[model samples]
Target: MRFPRTARLAPPAPAAAGDVLAEAERLHVRLGAREVLRGVDVTARAGEVLALVGPNGAGKSTLLAALAADLRAGAGVVRVHGRPAADWTAPELALRRAVLPQSTALSFPFTVEEVVRMGRAPWAGAAGTDDEAAVAGAMAATEVAEFAARPFSALSGGERARVAFARVLAQHAPLLLLDEPTAALDLRHQELVLRVCRERARAGDAVVVVLHDLGLAAAYAHRVAVLSAGRVAADGPPAEVFTGELLSDVYRQPVEVLAHPRTGAVLVAPRRDP
Candidate 1:
């Protein structure tokens, strides 16, 4: 899980304050008879990682889709870069933001590098020769360079997941929307993915990720938004928002939030039944 120092891109210039990269206000969406998201209001800002955490069926994925502009909201508004998401052309939106869904189904037989190179399509006219560097750097960062020549369909779940992440990294968008980026990874790879998220935020990209792992969310996210029953239960800094009582109530389970003894980082765990 080691990455070469040279593979890391230099941090980009910091974004201006109060610059909202993506925002969803009073967003509502329904699928079939069930309302998936209910009046959810969330904003992702430059240079920050916002982790969306909630139990299953809490509408985390639905909200993420809305933010990515992949799903139309039944009500309210979703804006990216201060403009309505629907107004942006597909190519323009691809350059401004990238999305990694929970799962991808690619029936085409494409090499790993080819799949990663697809991310640069939006910039094909402007990127010139730089696309090679972007693709190589992305593969290196995700530790998928060794599989560049192999067919993407041949890779294992974790390997494919890493390659998929590399595709998003290669996109080089200002805003990133990731849904369950670490779900298919091993423990080490999970940490690696979250570390990549922090690095992206440091590079001035706004990142909003849906994470089921509360501990990972607490450790990496600058802000944590807890969703309960399709509503935002709490939103703030991890240390301030992720309390034992709040998490337990929102998740409808016995959960505990403790401070790490040495690092003072928040630790979340489910309580054992007595």
Candidate 2:
């Protein structure tokens, strides 16, 4: 799996819909003695939501971190915007991508608005940046504007998750790497978050998200990459990749993949009846 190496710091051409924003080619990553990813290949494309789905220990988060340049790939390469991820400086990477980790914990007491505004720091002193509008718009979109002044430390788990997501939206980067954005949300907020992901993709941003919920991945993701034992078991549209046999085998449980009676949306659930 040899890849042509692009020059460091080369100017990337203007990206459009269907363009690849980030990708992992023959990527392998190790954490201490444990190899988390092995020979994995995946891509995040503009105007699409690509979801990483698998059971625990499937290397989903490790792959996302590698693509974000937070983790070094031991064997292969991670490319972002036409160059190796290692070539980009932290500030440069911040301008091109925004990341949301699984945990949204703030040690200090900061207001919701203040926490959201922290996302704009990367754009400060840059010409033509409307900080206030970005902040307000993000808050409104995440439905957190009403509690803008409340302390982040005082918010509930779900509220904190939404506020953290508002911060990512405020960053306004072309690529978004989100790890379990819907894990802490209720039904309505979960739907809201996926809707926003779809909106971002429709607006020509590339979104890569790690989702534990198979139903959510089936319902909202434009494509699904099903991982198993540190490799991609299958990757394709939900209707194609999410068959019961594959999912059941990957998850190590008897599972059922069904379609909604009216809307024909894909549905996944563990098999309970003997």
Candidate 3:
């Protein structure tokens, strides 16, 4: 289906709590001895949504991992809640941050609610303080409550995405880190998930999402950080960073930057349909 005719508007920054959710300090990352990121500096503050956009293998996912404190930097720092990530206890960190990787693996057959509730595991501790009300609220907010009891694997791709997002919301963290969150879903589901992310940021959470869809990135993110060849190519407002020259330089393909007629947001399209 064609994209729903949305008036390309950047909603005002949602009402949020105090700012300062996360920071990256000259961060560098490597995986299995392969250098993935180089001298990357980034930050996410409450009340705003940040989207990371890049060509394939541009280290988008690596940067997300570093910001989430999943990957240790070789020479820089990742601070969560204004403190070095390593200093926070695992449970404490989990309580204040949440991450949704590109995919989830569930071997056991459990209802959708079960997988989402697992996000609360970080806070539940041994005695399992996972409040039932919190779980229900998260599910409801993510629009997964309708299928809470359905088997996860049995659900469609979009349904599973909603459930996964519901799980992250259950963590109730002030910071959210997501990787390729809308890669597989249709346009409708993509909008649904992005809306949920926007809702959380409006509620005072700091949000950083990795996205391949530049159009969605433009529409939803307050800022867009473009990465190329393991370094930040450009980082600023979408219209400023998504220039015709920058887009061509980063992707090595001619592209057009169109100003949306309604929201005034910038939309990127390939110069050649191919």
Candidate 4:
């Protein structure tokens, strides 16, 4: 679909470090009378996993929507595959990227397999066998195969989360946008979800996942982008971005960030003021 003249497109860019894959450059978005994103800049190199974090109403989801081009940013750029996000047609964009919004609601009693197969709809004339294979592979990866024949509406919240993730995997887009993929997952499934995200990055897909768990972001993100009040508070490797001062300032609470004993990854936890 063609956007109007008022739309903001990215300034011509030569990829920074010659490695940018997908990004938002000074992107801004407003909702009705309220501004949700205030000129956010983000970048993810090929095969990198970017963890997005912020308090509720901080615009983490809004930023994700802009990145996926589902929501237009008011006055900045969102680029995918080195081009303005608007440059791609719907079908082209679908083949190039996939987004899993936080709330995916379907009142109909669709089977889990049916839901996953919907991801393959982006492609034209994709064989049923091929679609089924993709569906099966995704279900297996998420360990949700047992529920494939079950109705999505009948599954528990976490079960539905996993099944939805399986759909994104089936999409096989080079870029992925996930909002709270582990919101209701058990510990084991949470780890599995992160592993699947990491494995996707390893295979050259760029991933941006919204996460509320600071510890998980520190442990899994190739980089973390912390948003506070609609702007990027810190963007860097976890150790640098999740610092005590940064966290305390952004979160408005006392906190501590220490290096993990084994992996040297940064660890964060709340600390009392006294």
Candidate 5:
């Protein structure tokens, strides 16, 4: 997977804080005869981590795909970097956004370093690019450098997820769309992943992540979009959106939202019945 260094791609310009990098307005998406997303409106902003959270089959992943322009909008519009999603050529879109799918499967036995290096493929042959630095930085950021030479298929599920994330980081695109990045990780790695998301947002990259863990979303996301039945049930700061009433109803289970005893962070848990 070697890319020529002689080809040049213009990097995306730096984004200002609060700038909307991606947005779906009145969006509708259908897969076969079923509508997976219905009239959803959401935005990913520069310098912010936006988490999409909900119960299973709530359309979190589908909405993420729509934002990434992988799925065509059945109605309304999806915009990336201020232009209609369809307007950007694949190469052009690659320059501005990077996506981490729910799973990463490779038929070939590529090493961790090789996989991470693939992220730089979009910037290949682009002037002033340092592929080595980008790859190394991404691996380090995701804590995957320790296994750089291991075969991708040899790693555990959590390890593979980190490596996949490193690849996305290496792309250095201004917008990031991640699907359940913490799903396979341990407690520590889950925190690590969200910390990296916050770091990216701080550096002015827009991050939209689909999360099933409400606690992580409460802690890391600058804004939370709670999805239910293919629609945005609530969208706002976690403090405002993650009420016990809302969550209990959306999940169809007894749930509770509490403030951390020591740090005042939001904590969500199921209400145990006596």
Candidate 6:
């Protein structure tokens, strides 16, 4: 599949210093008998795309949930906009951040446009809320405007994914926590999703995305955080954190990192032994 030149564009500028938007400090979380996060410290600042990448069960999703205030930390603190996440009322938090879960199962029969408009619920009855405009803009950006009248339950997985993303976009929150936003998308759509993330960051929003594709993380993220065994194994620029040795060690597989000859972008691939 061919990608647009935009895919090769330089990473977005780093967020300004002292502009931390969301953070998890010394956070520990457990689900039933399993501890999902351990003393993890992660931060998302305005104007940056921070990708959380790791092998399965590495706590990337768990950490994102904590940062989104969807899951509580057993210990330590989670803050959004410099205040405790727990302190923000649901409506208040919804106005400041948006979350896209790993899987969205909608059994109810709702039109695509209706589903996207649901994102504006937090702004309901609020002064100066442009519900229709936000929903239309989001659908157009996600390429779901064509199917606005279709039932969300009847759409394909990829289509549903785009619609779901439209909802998050409609929310227009400063902080976006997306879990596997491109998981069900095609090659082009995957790039589209990541490009949207870059666009959001460039517009001064903070994005924290859980990505399994190391290459995507390297290409789009201004900063990459590698999580392993419920802890951050590495955190820094993609070129520095995505070294072959570090990736191979953390992923428990022989992975190779190479630079694109022309673009100088980091490329990640797994080594196959014959």
Q: Best by TM-score, which number?
A: 5
Estimate every model's Cα lDDT from 0 to 1: 0.89, 0.91, 0.82, 0.84, 0.95, 0.90
Q: Output the lDDT of residue 220, model 1.
A: 98
- The model with the greater lDDT, 1 or 2, is 2
Residues 70-101, candidate 3, lDDT per residue (tens digit)? 88888789998778988876666776779998
Distance from true location, Cα of 132 in model 4, Å: 2.7
Residue by residue across 1-24, what tens digits does model 1's lDDT show?
112222222223346644799999
Candidate 2, run of 10 with poorest lDDT: 1-10
Supply every candidate's count of residue pairs whose N, Cα or C atoms clash at under 3 angstroms: 0, 0, 1, 1, 3, 0
Q: How does residue 144 of candidate 1 score in lDDT?
A: 98
Per-residue lDDT of 1-274 in model 5, one digit per residue for the tens?
Answer: 6886644657778999999999999999999999999999999999999999999999999999999999999999999999999999888899899999999999999999999999988887787778899999999988999989999999999999999999999999999999999999999999999999999999999999999999999999999999999999999999999999999999999999999999999999999989
244 Cα displacement, candidate 1 (Å): 0.9
lDDT of 2 by residue, 126-152 (tens): 666688999999999999999998999
- Candidate 3 Cα misplacement greater than 4 A, ranges: 1-18, 125-130
Instruction: Estimate the lDDT of model 2.
Output: 0.91
The residue pairs in collision within model 4 are 28-74
Q: Is candidate 1 or candidate 4 better by lDDT?
A: 1
Best lDDT among the predictions, by candidate number? 5
| lDDT (Cα, tens digit) per residue for candidate 4, span 1-274 | 1112322222222333326667899888999999898888999776788999988898999998888888876899998877898988777678777899886789888899888887776754533326667778999999889878999999999999998999899887878899999889899999999999999888877889999989889888989999999999889888778888888888888889988899777889999665
